[model samples]
Target: MKRIFEELAFVNVFAPQSVEKTTDKTTAFVDTSGAGEVAFLVSTAALGAGKKVTVTVMGSDQSTGASAKAIGDAVEFSDSVGTDPQTIVVSYQVDPANPRYIGLKFQHDGDAAVLCGVAVAGRSLYLPAANGWTVAK
Candidate 1:
């Protein structure tokens, strides 16, 4: 038998730094074909006073993001307190019926360009899993 380790099946990195404050970024589509769960992480430098940024997780059927669309409403993060730097993450459970590719989009509304990193991680479902689970002595 093998330890499942909740294997990290795949990862995609975007905009390690140098995110333009006025431009929007749509990341390259990442294949999520076999992952059972996916996590999206966005780490950003100080967001500048009164500035705002929006993070969106989207899905597409094509690697070029030809059919891209947000999975849900874009989430907004603001530096209401001024110069707030933070890391935010969103997780999604893979649905076999949905498109097999996903990506991230960042929209910045501020005057200062911030250093940011976006990472998408795909994790496999636990091995030896069945339709139901049970505990034994």
Candidate 2:
């Protein structure tokens, strides 16, 4: 078995006043042109009262266009009033031919913005005939 690691796509902290009130903050696009499996690592500094966060994988056939579609259901992590810091990690598999571009979406909901950090990575194994592997450089 071959193993590969992707580069860190994004690393930043998001706060209520910094981000949009009702919108999704997507990370830098990753070229998963030949990747068979992708993974996302999401972490948060701290969560305020009535705050929640959801992470999902988004894909597209074209680098930049309207053909992009969400890969699957979002993985949600919520915090109640006066909760501690939280973190979530998830992975997803994709159709190598369909999802050429891969990215992560960070969705936040609450009266106050909760500081959060998100990063994405991907890996792929060589096909039987190709005998080669690719990863984020």
Candidate 3:
């Protein structure tokens, strides 16, 4: 029998780009301060849509709470799982200015965290940064 392994998924948000002063070619990570969405690349072999993904965000400040609106605006893959040859990506509206730590929890079926993944605190989301908040996932 083949052993199944837990995986670390990479989550990123593609901030909009601007027209270069010298060139017209577009770019990635340009002007990240503007409005955008938080996105993640998931492994279909591991998870799928409507799979009850729990996203958690944390930061360094006590006054700041995870942006619920941001997570709510996320868009899920339609036919991504087991279909798209490329990595599955999901997007959620979020504020770039805020320090953010995001975690996405999917149904693990029966995979034990000790065996395949690291254990995450249920509510210990925020962390201390220089002086700001960030995604804790």
TM-scores for candidates 1 onward, in order: 0.75, 0.65, 0.27
lDDT of 1 by residue, 53-122 (tens): 7888788998888878888788887777665676778777777676778888887776767787887777
lDDT of 1: 0.75
Reference-based lDDT, each prediction: 0.75, 0.62, 0.30
Clashing pairs in 1: none
Candidate 3 worst ten-residue window by lDDT: 21-30
Q: Candidate 3 at 76: error in angstroms? A: 8.4
Provide the lowest-lDDT 10-residue window in model 1.
1-10
Q: What is the C-alpha RMSD of each candidate to the true structure, in Å?
A: 4.7, 6.7, 18.0
Model 2 pairs in collision: 16-113
Question: For model 2, how does the per-residue alpha-carbon lDDT over 1-137 read when each residue is reduced to its tens digit?
Answer: 43333432333322223443446887655676566666666665556666778777778766552456777888777777546766777676767545777777777775555555566565554556543555537
* Rank ordering of all candidates by lDDT, starting from the highest: 1, 2, 3
Candidate 3 regions exceeding 4 Å error are 1-35, 46-87, 96-99, 108-137
lDDT of 2 at 48: 68
Give one digit per residue, the lDDT tens place, for model 3 in 8-124: 223233222221212211111212122244444443233333232232333222222333222333333333352222244444344555444444432222121211121221111
